[model samples]
Target: MLFDLPDDAVLYTALLARDAAWEGRAYVGVTSTGVFCRMTCPARKPKRENCRFHETVAGCLEAGFRPCRRCHPLACGSGAEPSVAPLVAALEADPARRWSEDDVVARGFDPSTVRRAFKRQFGITFLEMARLRRLRESAGVLAKGGKVIEAQLDAGYDSPAAFRAAFAKLLGQAPAKFAEDALLRADWIDTPLGAMVAVSDRSALHLLEFSDRPALPSSLRHLLKASKGSLGLGRYAPTDQVEAELGAFFAGQNATFRTPLALEGSEFTRTVWQALVAIPAGETRAYADIAREIGRPSAVRAVARANGANRIALVVPCHRVIGSDGALTGYGGGLWRKRNLIELERGYARA
Candidate 1:
């Protein structure tokens, strides 16, 4: 609600005028074409009736709209920018390639320029992005019941030990420990923001956190202990469903995640989490607001504590809460991600 476009008239005026002021802050989801574009998109304007104003690109995507190709909204600040696109494309086309700073220079791009572009667009260096791509490539195989050695080779790791160490560092478990038939399974999900880890049983998702979160390992360990160590690595129905819903969510569609969740927390914490789920997307509430909603008006600090304790990220909508002063608050996931999620939901998108 940052841009606060409550009326179609006002939104349409901005759209018709191609207001750059609303470019990232406002989006128009065109019903006829089933696509969303920034307010500054040069595509012919749709009728006001076919236009639905959204606060974030994610909001548009959640409403079942795709990004408009002409405007290329997702490319604005992404590593896919004109200067960096060729290198990004090359890396993506061969994700397992061992990328180095020297290799970038050899490819006729200045290493410093490439580094800055990637850092600005993806919040990661080009080499780091390459490494993550390799990990993702390998992890996908592991998630589908591939052997440890196979995954190691797939990721371009030189040896089993190296692969195991890297995989363990990222997932808190070595590749060999990932049993195909274990009761609970962990899967990797790629997103525009970064990678996420999803652990699920047959019927419900138990954990969802950004892979880089320092707390992820401990959280997964807790879930394993709670389930009596009946955990492994692979995909489940819930993981698959959530991934698909996440795809829609990132694409600017209204994706209602019907995937069931199974989280372990105190009764009070559970109540707070459910309250978070009740918060609508594209909107935010203060911790005090949540405390009041939960009928615990004096428990503002407790509400913030419970919010921080939430393990499920987007599904729980904990990011929808801000500080009482309207400033962004702490998120176990980087505050940058929190800000991005807020803007994404509010239709103020970045590349």
Candidate 2:
């Protein structure tokens, strides 16, 4: 789900008032200065015509505007939660360290408080974030033909069983289970937002999701079952195509994705996906709107369920769906990413 911003006139008024309500939801890019700032920035305001409002920092950057030095608009989302900032910094400082609840307590912070803060801001606990980072590193080593023991050490896991459990939690299988030659392959694709895991066969992409998504393990399990355990580590033709298209999309070069997709769902779900693709990049549709468009005007909830069940991420454009009230609802990729995607597409509309 994405935040629907008000018209420019109303947004300008909010900017003039330095409204705190719009601090993270809306930003104004100053055309004259070539910079973007949060609504609560204390710097002098620009004239109405010279101001351009966007819903995300990615939008500002795509439009060729640098972050304002005074406001530091980029930090408003990640650093706004005071309790989460220091922990994020520490994680960045030593990403490979095996973090634990005891370590948080030793840092003079309550473990529960830290957990809640991280969950509220990033949609994951601090320890979960650390574990995901370590696992991703380990996955990289395995992808490059490294041994399981080497990968475990690289991820900073002292116990083999602990490492296997953690890896299985994220991937739904142990590192050793992946075959050297398989029909369907999985690979990592880095994007502007984060790293995404892409699973594909020779002709079509089966799955594309953020590596840290909680639902990833279940999704992988389902995919493996469907593929009859013919899943391994490597890219297929579809993976390469999607990687390029995603790169272009984030770079603001092209919004269209032509990669072939192997959609695995019921007829109704597939219909919903078609309706989603018909939506223009810069616009959004509510569940009711999608239902009506799909010729099932009363199936709003069903449409929402199908949207959630979608496996291929941006290529299917599930992020283009929002609540009926224009509020961003639940997005599997995280609300922060949903906002960025919605705002980033506005550049496509302008182009």
- The C-alpha TM-scores of every prediction are 0.68, 0.70
lDDT of 2 by residue, 1-351 (tens): 223676677889999899898978888877567677999999999998577677665455434455677887645778767767787767766767899999898888999998888777655688977776577668878887888899999888978888889888877898788877888888877665666889999999999998768889999999889878888888889998998898678656789999999999999999999899889999999999999988999998899999999999999999999999999989999998899899989988888
Q: By TM-score, how accurate is candidate 1?
A: 0.68
Please list the residue runs of candidate 2 whose C-alpha ends up more than 4 Å from where it truly belongs after superposition: 1-95, 104-129
Error of 1 at 325 (Å): 0.5
**lDDT, residue 76, candidate 1:** 45
Give Cα-based local distance difference scores for all models.
0.76, 0.82
Residue 239 error for model 1, in Å?
Answer: 1.9
